[model samples]
Target chain A: MRQETSRAQAPIPAVAGIGLRFPHHRAVREDRPAIGWLEVHPENYLGGGAAIACLEAVRRDYPVSLHGVGLSLGSVDGLDPRHLDRLAALVSRIEPGLVSEHVSFSTAGGTYLADLLPLPMTEEALETVCRNVEVMQTRLRRQVLVENPSSYVRYVASTIPEWEFMAAVATRTGCGILCDVNNICVSAANHGFDAYHYLAALPAAAVGELHVAGHALRELGGGRQIRIDDHGSAVSAEVWALLAAAVARFGRRPTLVEWDNAIPALDVLLAEAAQADTILSRERDHAQAA
Target chain B: MPKLRDLQAGFAEVVLAGRFDALAPYLPADAIPPEDRLAIYRNTARAVMTEALRLTFPAVERLVGRDFFAMAAARFVRQAPPDTADLAEYGVALPDFLAHLPEAAPIPYLADVARFEWALHQAATAEDAPSLDADALGAVAAEDQPMITFIPHPSVRLLELATPADAVADAVLAGDDRAMAAIDLAAGPRRLVLHRGATGVCAEQCDADAFAFARALFAGATLAGLVDAAPAAAGTLLAGHLASGRIAGYALQTQTGEP
Candidate 1:
C-alpha cells in the first residue's frame, strides 16, 4: 500500500498561509493570493465534484497541505483503514507539501464524535498515540505532523504533562509536530499553564508546521472563561503574542491561519496571513543578522 | 488510576450522553468543576454535529427555522452519532429520521426536501468519470451500437418525489425567503434527473419515459434492449443522453460470454 503513492513533498517553505475554506476557493483559484500555501481538510475533498476541480485549479499556483481533522489518531480501536486509503488517494492526487492530524481522538467504539476530544497524558495514552502515529506514517509513506489538541477537561488519569506527552510521541514514533499556537494558548489558559513554557518544551527540529487561529471566550459560571478555539473571527492579541514566542523559540516555520466558522472575506484572512508573514519576515531577518 | 480506555469511554459517555456524574471519576477537579469541563465537550460535540447536519440539509433547516431545526438536529445527533469521521459523509439517515418526527408531520414534505438535498450533495461530491466521446461511438459499427451498455458517471442521481421539493430547493438556492411560504405542492409530481455535466451538476424534470430510460441506463441495461422495449422514442432518448455525458461510457456484452 505504501508503494501505491510516490509523491515526495518538500518541506513547506517558512512563509505564512491560509486554511482555504470554501468561501475563498474561487478567490484562491482566480486571484492566486500572495500567501505562501493553502491548507485544506482532506475529508472535505474525499469525494469528487466542483470542490475537487476548484482545488485542482488552485493547486497549480500554491503548495497545498492536507491537514486531516478526523484521523482519530489516539483511538484505542486504532485508525480506520478506509479513511487512510481515501486519504492516501487524496495525498497522491494533491501531492501536498505537508500532511497532518491531531494528537486527539475523535472516534471510539465504532462511533465518531464530531469534535476532537482530548486524550489523557498518561503512559497508556502515549503508547496508543505512538502506535497510531506509526500506523499513519507507514500507511501514508510520509512523515506526518501530529498536532496538540485544545482541551477543556483535564483527565484525572493524566500522570504526565501535555508537553512531555507531545515530545514523547515525536521521540518514539519519529513524527513531526504541527504546533498550533492558538491551541496551546487555549489549553494553557484553560489548564492554568504558561503558554511560553509549553512552546519551549517542544523539540525545535520536530516542529514542522504551525497553526494560528482565532478563538472565542466561553464564560462559565464561576467567572472562569474557557478560550474555545472556534477559528471564527480575527486572531486575538494574546494568541499573536504566543505565536511570536513560538517563532522566537522555534525559528520561522510554515504558519497557517485557520478560520473555519463564521469565515470572513478573503481579504480578512489575507490580512491575518500578512500579520504572520510580517512576524516571520522579522524573525528570519533577525536570525540572519545575528 | 483509570486506564486510557476507561477515560475515553467516560469522556465519550459525557459527550454523547451528557452523563457527567459517570465521567467525573476520570475528570480531575480543577479550578472549574469537572462537570463544567464535561459540559464544554458535550456542547462541542452537539454543536459540531448540528453544524454538519445543517450544512448537509440546509433546505430542511431553512424550512423548519433555526431554533426548531437545531432542536430536531440535536435530538438526531444523540440518536445517530456519525459512524464515519468525515462529517461530509455523516447524516446518511437524516431524511429517514425526519420522516418519523411528530413535529415534522405538519410539513410532511420536509423529509422529501432533505432527501433531495442529500441527493444533490451526493451528485456534487461523486467521482468524476471519463465520458466516452463521439469518436469511440462512431468507431463502433452501427449494427453493434444498440447492444452497447452506456454507463453514467458516479455523479448521476435521480429524485422522484410527490411534493414540489424541486421548487422549494430552487427557493432555497435563490435565497428567496418569501417564495418558500408561497410554495405550491400542486405543481404535480417531480421526476428529476440530477446529472453532472462538464460544467457542474444540474437538475431537470424528466417525463416518465425519459426517467425510465435513465433508470435503465443506471441499472446497466443495454441500448438495443431499451430501444426494442421502447422503440417509439429510442432515437431521441439515446441522442439526448449520449450528448449530455450521462452516457459516460459503454460496453458491448458478448453473446457467448467471450468478449
Candidate 2:
C-alpha cells in the first residue's frame, strides 16, 4: 500500500508520447527526441540497470508513464504479490505520471503466456479484473489505467461487449482506461464490429491515455483477412483514422506510439510520434473550432 | 457456461499444449475456428518466449541457426514459461537446459558460453549504484583500512569461463558468423570479472590471483586475514580493483575477531 501526497504532480504531459524501448535508449538520451512524453514497459525497468539509468536521464527532461505489460490484471488466480511488489518498487522509484496495465490476463497455473490474452466479457471476468485493478491501485497507491486488449478470439461464455466490460472495470474499481486505438481496430477487424461503435461506447471521462500502434493484416487460408496487433510496422492509415475518431470522442489524451518488434531507429519512432502529434493537433484544433 | 477461472484454466492449457478440445467449451465456434483463434495466442507466446531466449543466448542461436534455436526455445518455454513478470529474468534454466540438449551435445561449450552471456546480461541489468570514490576510502584510518572490505559494484559478476565465449562474442559483434563457428573452444579456464564499465558491461580476463583476492574481499575477508590465509598479491590485486569502478563501495568492520 502506498500513500499519495495530494499535491502530487502528473507523471506524463498531455502530449504525444513514444514507447521507450531499449534499442533507442541512447539516441533518446543523446539526441533528446522531440516527442512530448515517453512511456516504458515497467517490466523492462524492474531489475534496474542500464534501462533504469537511461530512464533516469530521460526523466530529467521528460515526464514518463509506466505502461506495464506483464501484471496479468485479469488473471483469475489472483495478483502475483511478487510482480506487484516489483511494480510497487518501480512505481516508487520512477514516480511515473501514469501507471497503466492491460485488462487481459497473461499468467495461469504458474505459466505466463507472455501475451495479453483476452478475458471473457462475463460478469465474473469483469469482477475479477476490477478486484485485481483495485488491488493494484491500492498497492501502488495510484489509480492504474486498465487498457483494453486486442483479441483474436471471443469466448462463448462472454455476454458483455468488450467496451461494456472496459466501462464496468473503470466504473467498479475507479480505475482509468488506456484505450489502445489500434487494439480496438484490430479486435473490430477480427470480431466483425465497427471500431467507431467501440470508441463511441467507451466512458469518455475514464480515458487516461491512448495508444496508437501499427498492425499487420494477415490473410488466413479461407481468404479471411484479419488484422494482427503486431507493433512491427508503421501505424497504418486506417488506425490513424480510428485514432482521429478516438481523439474526437475522448478529446486529446497523452497518446503513445508503440513499436516493440524489430523496433526502428529513434528517428523513426520520433517520426511516428510526430505523426501522432500532428493528428492530435489537428483534432484539438477541430475540437476548439467546434 | 464455465466460470471465468475455468475458462482461463482451459485456455492456458490449450495455449501451452495446443489442446483445443479441452478448451472448446469456452471458445465460440465463430467464423474463425477456436483452434485458429488459440493459434494466435500460441504463436505470440512461442514467439515472445523464443525471442527472449534468442536475445539471452544469441551465440547459441548463431551456433545452431535460428530455426533450430526457435524449436529448442519452444521446448524450453513449455518446461519453464517465465515465473518472473520481467522478460529479462526469463530463461534462468536455459544454461542447464542447453547442457542436456542432445542437439547441443556436440557443442558442449555452448552452455558455458550461454552462462557467460547470462552473466554479462545480469551485470548489465543489475541495479545501478554509485561507485565508491577515493575520498570515501581515504577517510578511513590507515590501520582500520586493512580491516575494511571492498564492495563489488552492483553490476559486477565473476566467472571462471573456459570456452570460446570470448571469440564467439567477438565474431558476433563483428557480424562474422563464420568466425564464430570456427572458434576453438578448448581454451583453458580463464578467471574473468564481468562489470559494467564506463563503456558498458564487458568481461575482461584477469589473473587468477587477482580474481581470488577480489572474491575473498567481496566475501568479507579482511585484507590482513586474506594476506595471512590467501597467497600473496591479494592486497595488490584489491588495490588495482579499488582504483577502478569495479569497487562499488567500501565498508569497515574493524576486525571481526576471527583469525
Candidate 3:
C-alpha cells in the first residue's frame, strides 16, 4: 500500500501550514490567507453537512490534508474496516494533499478511550502500527504520515526509545513522519529524556510534516510537574525555541499550528501560524546563506 | 516489567473502567499521579463521545437541557460503548438505552423520543442514493406485480412512539423549550415514519398500510408478500408510497410455494 501510494505524488512543497478549525473556516474561505497548506481531523468531517460543505469550499482553495485523531493504529486488535471506509470516503471527497494518523491507539476491545494513548516502544507494537498504517494507506489508495503521540506515562517494558520506534515504523511501512515538536518536549520533560537527543535521532528523510502546539504544566501534590499536551493555550516561548532547533535541523517542512481546545479567534491561530512561518523562513535563509 | 500488551491493556482498563488503583504501581514516579493522568483519558473520552452525541442528537439536546442531555449521555456511554470507530454509526442503541433507564422510566415517552432522534441522526448521514426516475417505475408491467419488491429510501426509518416525541424535536428546533419539563407525554401513542424528504428529514404519522409496507420493506419482504400480508390496504399504501418517492426501487419477489 505504501509503495503504491508513494508513487502517486509527493505532497505540496514543504512549508508552514495551519490546522483549519471550524471557527476559522469562514475566515479561510473569505480571506484565503497565504499559508503553505491546511490540515483537518477527518472524524470531524465524517458527517456530510455544513462542516463537510465548509471543508469542500476550503479544499478548493487550499492544499488540505486529513489528519486523523482516532484511527487507533497501534491497537492489538485488527483494523476497524468501517472506520477505514469512512476515512477512505473522506479522502476521496477532499482529495487531501496528505492523510495521517498517530502511532497510538485510542481504543481497544471495541471501547474508545478517545485519547492518543501511548504505545510501548517494543517490536510487537511497531509491527502492529506498521501493519495498520499499511492497511490504512492501501484502503485509502494514499500514503499516510504517522504522527508521534504525547506520552503521559512511559512503559517499563519499552525496548527502544520513541525515536527508534518511529523510525522503525517509517522504515518498515515506508510511511512518513509528522514530527510534533510540542509532543516531543512534553514527553521528554515528563520522562526525563533529553529533547535534543530525540530531535537528533529522528530519521530526517521520513519527516514529511511538523506539528507545533501549546501545552500547560500542572504541578502535582508531590511537586512533580506533568506537562500536558493540551493544545489549549498559545505556543510557549520554550516550544518556540524548540521549534527553532527543529526547523534549523530539518529545514522548512509543512508545519501546522494545532490548537484543539479552547480555540481562539481566526486571526490568533493565523498569527501563530505566522510565527511558525517566521521560524521556517529564517531557517530557509540560513540554509541559503550557508 | 509488563510486556507492551500488558501495559496497554492495563491502561485501557484504567481509562474505560475507571480502575486506576491497579495502574498506580506501574506509573513512573516522575509523572503525575496515575489517577490524574487517567482522568485526562476520562475527560478525553467524555469530550469525544459527548461531541459525537451532540452531533447525533442536537435537537434532543436542545429539547432536554444540555446539562440533562450530558448526564443521560454519560450514562449511555458507560452502558453501551461504541462497537466501531465510525462515530457517526456509534450511537444507534441510545434510544434503547434510554428506554430501560430507571430514572427515565417516568418519562416513558423520552425513550421513543430518543428513538426518533436516532432515526433522524441515521438518516442525515446515510449514503446518498439517487431517486428512481418516473420512467423506471412506469416500465413495470401489471402482470409482473406478483413478483415486485420495493426499495425504501436509504435514509428512511420508521419509528413508533407512545407520544408525539417528534414535536419535541420541532419544539427544540423552534427554541420554545427551556427545560425537559416542556416534554408532554400525554400528547401521544404516535406512529410516525421519520424519513428524509426532498428538502430534509420530516416526521409524520404512518397510516396503518404505509406503516405495514415500510416494515415489510425494511424486513426485505417482497412487495407481493407485503400486499398478501396486508391485502385490504396494500394497493392504496403501495400507490401512496410510490407517488411519495418513499419507495425508491422495486424488484421481483419470487415465491417458493403455491401460496
RMSD of each: 3.2, 3.6, 4.3
| TM-score for all models, in order of appearance | 0.93, 0.91, 0.87
Pairs of residues at least 3 apart in sequence or in different chains that clash in candidate 2: A11-A97
Expressed as tens digits, the lDDT of each residue in A1-290 for candidate 1 is 55652322335789998998899888888887788888999988888888888887787777889999888998999999999999999988888899999999888787888788898888989999999999999998989999999988887678899999999999999999999999998999888998898999999999999999999998876777777888888999998888888899999999999999899999989999999998888898899999
What TM-score does candidate 2 reach? 0.91
Worst 10 residues of 3 chain A by lDDT: A1-10
- Residues A158-273 of candidate 3 have per-residue lDDT tens digits of 78889999999989888999999999999888888988888898888888888899999988767767888999999998889988998887878889889988999888888998
Q: What's the true lDDT of residue A126 in model 2?
A: 86
The regions of model 1 sitting more than 4 angstroms off are: A1-11, B141-146, B172-188, B256-259
- True lDDT of residue A46, candidate 2: 81
Q: Could you tell me which 10 consecutive residues in candidate 2 chain A have the lowest summed lDDT?
A: A4-13
Candidates 2 and 3 compared: the better one by DockQ is: 2
Q: Can you give the lDDT of residue B196 in candidate 2?
A: 85
- Candidate number achieving the greatest lDDT relative to the actual structure: 1
TM-score of chain B of each: 0.90, 0.89, 0.83
Worst 10 residues of 3 chain B by lDDT: B126-135
* Model 1: per-residue Cα lDDT over B90-181, one tens digit each: 87799999999999999888888998999888887888787767568787888888778877878789889988897897798789979977
User: How do the residues B1-259 of candidate 2 rate in per-residue lDDT, one tens digit apiece?
Assistant: 7877777777777767777787777776767777777788888887888888888788778877889898888888877778867888887799889889898888767788788888888887887777778678678888787777777888888888777576776687578979866877776777888888777887878777777766777787876777776656765676666666888877777644777
